[model samples]
Each structure stands twice: as structure tokens, then as C-alpha cells.
Target: MKRSSPAQISPDFRRTRVVDQTGIEERAARFTKRSIKQSSKLQALYQVLNMIDLTTLEGKDTDQKVRQLCYKARHPHDELSGIPTVAAICVYPNFVRVAKKSLEGSGIKVASVATAFPSGQSTRAIKLADTRLAVSEGADEVDMVISRGKFHAGEYAFVFDEIAAIKEACGKARLKVILETGELGSFDKVRRASDIAMHAGADFIKTSTGKIQPAATMPVTLVMLEAIRDFYYQTGKQVGMKPAGGISKSKLALHYLVMLRETLGQDWMSNEWFRFGASSLANDVLMQIRKEKTGQYQSAAYFSVD
Candidate 1:
């Protein structure tokens, strides 16, 4: 798990990898066409439930909100009987201690967003302090945003060094690098960012911060997954993928799973290697599971609105 310094990373970030947009779009579309048996659908639904990172990131967030989110992450649906809890509870750095205490012994991790979060427009000193505070507060994972401005300005070395510094600041906690692909403006940029992140020591490459439009499209995720697949082939190292934002339906989650299975095989199937950074996605999955069990769908009001 040794991380590469900026000096060790390739300087040619402008062309780390080029993406074929038409082929990526067509391939991504084909994944949705795969037919699933009812039994397999149910299994996928449960798997989706387990792979979710129930998240709550907002300016008006309160201690009570983090606790409630932690409760949901631990319980999910008490009546489901044998249903698995979510993989983690993601929140702001200030609430990491609250979420950590609330999820004690439940096996659910507390993930905090750092590095100025959605904007990532701040000094590197502040970003490292932000990461350290979360880890000190008992966060099991740190989700950080790469400096999109620097990346766009061709300051790839700065971006790589920042991530490596944050990875070091994370101590024992896992680091999830948010590429915020929505603003990258092209599939080629997304691929380049993904390569930079994995090389700079990102435990996971995330699609978005959930604050931007067009977050986590199948085509974009496909590009990132393909980057991960290629990087693994070259380095024999495994990196996780989390397509955050805009994915709230069970069918769409199943499509992403199909793509992951086909692209990365069974080694990356678990929550350890794949995650959905969508809180609302949990409710939709629960509804699907209940529908499968009772032959009917439950009203959305039946679930908590955290």
C-alpha cells in the first residue's frame, strides 16, 4: 500500500489515457439490456443494499441528523429479516465523531468528506487539517475532492501531490478521491483524473460530490471502471469505485453492478471494492426487496426521510 509521490507519477497527465466516447456510450448502453431472472434480481437488490454508503452532507446538518443516518445505516429495515446493513455512513468532518459513536459495534463505517468538500477551493494546509480532524474524530474513511481548478490548469503534479499528502494525513483511514466528473467536461479528462488518483494513492475513485448536475452517468462510470481495470492489469493493484449522485433506482443500480461484474469480475463485487454514494438509493432498494418478498410495493412514506 505504498503511495507514489508526485515525482514518481508520470508527468504527461494531459494524455494519460484517451477515451472513445462512442464506444463507451454504446458499451454502457448494452449493459442495461442484459436480462435478469426474478431470483437474480432479488439477489442483486440485496447486494445493492449492502453496497450503499448512506450519506448526508448539507449546510443545515445537525448532530441529530447524523445520528439518525447512523441508525438507518445500522438498521436499514428491521422487518426485512436477514437483510444486510449499509456499508458506511458518510457525513461532514464535524459530524464524524457523532456518527462514529452512533454506529459503534454495528460494523458500519463513518466516512467524512474533506478537502473543502464540494468546492475544493482552499489552501492545502487547510485541507490537511480538515482530513486530520476527521481521522482524529474516528472516521474510518475520508472522501476528498481533487482540486478541479488545478487539474484543469494542467497542474497535474500539484493535484497528485495534494492527494498523496492527504493520503498520508489519513493515517490508517481509507481515502476516497472524488474526481467530480460532472465538471471534468469530457470522458478523456475523467480517465486522466482516475489514473492520477489511483497512482497517487486513492483507495477509491469517486464520480461526484453529489452537488453537481449530471453526476455519475453510466458512460462516465464506465470510463472510470475501464481505467481501474487497465490500471489493475498494469500494476496488479485493486482500487474501488463509487458512482455517487443521481442513481436512486434499483434497476439502475443493477445495471451498474452488471457493468462492474463484466468489467472487473468477482474480485471487485463486494462493498470493499464497490459502493453507491447515494442515501436515497437505500429506500428504493428496500422497497424493491419488500416488493419481492410480499408481491407489492410499499409507499415511500414508510421509510424515514433523513
Candidate 2:
């Protein structure tokens, strides 16, 4: 497919919505107050398990670690029958091939963090090359961090073009632009970054790299979801959302699902359109599932700490 030029595709960043801080915080708080029944809670726990992108991005990562994560993704909890596999296995670019080979035919995607992940402080040439390397290594999806420095300097066009260039380099792989909302500092900047990414052809807009503090808060995610909703309305295009880092509880994941349903509606409920970029979340969800089935909570020792 031919890619659109940044100038021809990107929306006017200056016109992006100015997020209402108080309103966003209050509304996001409302999602937590929602009461879920037993049956619905069980269903939501299963869905949360299915939507997780089990990840291992540590520098100490080895082939064995990637393989183990792939095994866990394939069989989350063998003790529980009918437990669905996770949405994907996320790793650094170096492990993309290892993960792809390990997860062959399991229908789980291998997502690689590219474009100088967690910090977009490299040259454009290097960033594009990083994206190409991941794609060439058989990555189904690429998670990229935007140039936060440039965005903070009011260099919106540079950030947009960088994302577009990386999208072009992604080829057939889905591109996930990580805004690193924690570093973006404010909800308004988060909204602008979301628009820039969607208009620049991001298949998904992610919240963090799990390497930064204050990553992926409910208010921040709410702002990004609203941005996605407005973009879908304007262009008739759909983009996925991934909230990485700091979300480790099953109840919080359920609240996120409620916020998604209320904000973007049912169209974005599936794993294809929404994902939780978490490693520990899967174990919590599995524990909840086991609890739901046996009427007793199992020790976290039963789950692997990947």
C-alpha cells in the first residue's frame, strides 16, 4: 500500500482539543465506581487476559526468557481449561525473531519495540532503520516512542513527519506510536500527540514504554481515548489504544474496559483494537480467573513471574 505524505495526511496539530483537566479526572474517577456483577466480572477477567501483550523488555533478557514468555502467552494457565492466549508477545527488536519462531502458528502476534524505544532521541535515519530491522525480523507490530523533546519544543511537524517516516518503514507491520504520556506532562499534550499519531498513520497509539515513572494513568488514558474517538468521527478511521505500565490489578483493568466502552463504544472492546501493555497483569488476571472458578484465591506463587 502506498503511504500518504505527512503534509497530506496529518491534521493541524494546533487545532487539537484542549483537554479539560478537572472534567477528565472526575470522569475517569467515575469509571472506578462502576459496580460489576459476578458473571460480568468473570467475563471481564477473561477478556483482560486475552487483551494483554505479555512483555519482556529488560536489558538482561535472553533467548530463554523470550521463549518462556512465548510459552506463557500460549498457555497462560494450564490449570484453567479454556484460558485464552494473550494478544501478543512484546520484546526488544533483538528478540523479535526469537519470539516469532517460538510462537509460530499460535495466532499470537510478536510485537517489537523500535525507533529507539522509551526514548526517541536518535536521528531519523537511525529510527527508520530500527523500525525496518524489527519488520524484517518478522515483527507483526512495532511500538515506537515519539520525539518528546521536539514535541515539547513545539516541533509538532517534526514529530508528525518522524512518525510518518517510521510508519512507511514498518511496511506490512502495524505501527504503534508510544507517546509516553507520563513524559508528555499534561493532558493537552497527550491529546495533541494522539492526533498527530493517528493522522500520521499509526495503527495504534500507546501510553508508555514501562520505563518511565507515572506511566499510563487513568486520566491520561481517558484523554487519549477521547482523542481516538474524535479522530474516528472526523476521518472515519479506527485506531487502537494500548495503556502500558503501572496497571497491574484486575479491577483497574476492568475499570479501563469500562472507560473504553463508555468512551469509544463496543467497536474498540476486542483485543484487536485495545491492549494492555503489561507483564504482571496477566498473572493477576489468571489468579482472578482461578478464584472465580474455585471460590478461593490461589497464591501468586502458582503463576510464573515473567
Candidate 3:
């Protein structure tokens, strides 16, 4: 079915239900309380590894670093058997070429963060150019930040237009719009932003840039998931979700998967529907998997530092 465009969505759509913050906190806490069997934990660890966007987004990102990160994405652990490669390698636009080259034929995608990244204060022309450059460099996916300044200033139209523009600039590349939920003030605002991003044609609505504090908390992620759910029901289009940053531990990652399964059902449980934006999360999950296999705790020293 042909989905409705962003223009067809009204302001009323952005006005999400008054978020129940206390209830949300309690529910999020309950997600962590649930435990898994050791056998199931091993399978979930592999699933976690495959869904990771092994990332290195920074001012210090180098060709060497990008290549190393790509290599890690391709071969998460040389010593481990039957370990699947990660979903992708996320890098700055300048390093897209290096990541693309290194990740060739590994079925690992190259993702670039454009639209001014942690801050979307730049002009649309500049942001489009940034996205185009990444696509030209072979980025399979483009992660763009929503204009938080505009969103906070009650400029919802501008925010929606910017994301739609970047989605066009991405060409054939998938677009992941980062809401930076931590900077959006409250869960209600987070829901509003998520609605805007999805209707604006975001293939994925992400929680953070991993640059902000309090990125991808369970409550925030739950709110975004709910937004995606409502959007899908209204438009008949499935938008992906990425809860980036601060999800470093394996147990936390499992809790996120549990949340994914419970909130959106198993249909949204795959990498095509969900992703984790982290540099060290791969290692932590790997360590946990190793621990389950050998009955001995593993060290961070053993895993490749990407």
C-alpha cells in the first residue's frame, strides 16, 4: 500500500497522549527484572552482536580507526565460533569511503551520521550536501539529526521539512533520523519528535547521537517505540528504531531486546527493524557470550577495541 506523506499528517498527529511518566518509569523497571535462561542468553548474545551498528563517530575518527572498526564489524571475535558479524559500521561522512572499502563483501553496511550530527544547526543546503557526500562515498545508511532547536522553539514545520529534505538527499541510502531524546526535554516531547520523524519519512527514528548525556534510557526508548507503533497503525508503514548510547552491558542489551519483543512484538525484533548504536557494546555482548560458553568471566582486553 502507498503510505501517506508527511504533508498529509496534521499537527494533531504530533500531539501525542499526555505521557504517564511515573507509569513509564515503573514499566521500564519491570523490563529489567525479567531474567532469561543461560541457554537462551547465548542465543540472545549472538542476536545482539548481529544487530549492532559498531560505531566510531568523533572528531578524532581516522581512516585507520574506521578501517579497524569495519574489520571488527566483519569479524567480531576471531577466537569465537559461529559468531555473526554486526549489522553495520557507523562513522563520520569523511570516513565513509574507508568503512565501505573495508566492509566490502562482508554484508556489513556503512552508515554515516550527517545533518550536523549531534547538533542540527546548519543550513539545509549544507546538511543535504553532507548527506550527498556520504551517499557518494557509499554509505548504505545515513543517520541525520532532527533540528532540536526548531522543535523546541515550537517550529515543528521546520523540523519536519528538514528531515524530509535530508531523506531526499540520502538518495538510495536509508535514513535514520536521530531525535536526541535526551535533549528534547521530556517523554511527551520525545513522542512528538518521534511522530514528526516518522511522518517526515524517516526509515528509522533513533534515540540519540551518543554525544549527549542520558542517551537511550529505557523510558525514552519505550516512548519512541510507542510512537513508532502509533505511526505504523496510522500510516501502515513500519519505521525502524535505534536506541543508541549508554547501552554498554550485555544484560542491558538483552533487556532492550525484551522490550522490543514485548512492546512491538517479535516482528520488530530483527536488525532490519532495530539497532544499537555503540562502539563497545559489541565487546560486552561478546564477553557475555564467552562467559556463557566457558563458564568463566571474560575481559574487555580480549575483544577488539573499535
lDDT of 2 by residue, 24-108 (tens): 9999999999998688999999999999999998999999999999999998989779999999999999999999999999999
Q: What is the C-alpha lDDT profile of model 3 across 144-227, one tens digit per residue?
A: 999888898888889888888989888889999999988999999998998888878899999999999989999999989888
Clashes of 2: 0
The runs of at least 3 residues in candidate 1 whose Cα sits more than 4 Å from the true structure, single-residue gaps closed, are 1-11
Residue pairs in clash, model 2? none
- Each prediction's TM-score versus the true structure: 0.96, 0.96, 0.96
Kindly provide the TM-score of model 3 when superposed on the true structure, using C-alpha atoms: 0.96
Give all candidates' CA lDDT scores. 0.93, 0.92, 0.88
For model 2, the stretches where C-alpha displacement exceeds 4 angstroms are 1-9
Best to worst by lDDT, what's the order? 1, 2, 3
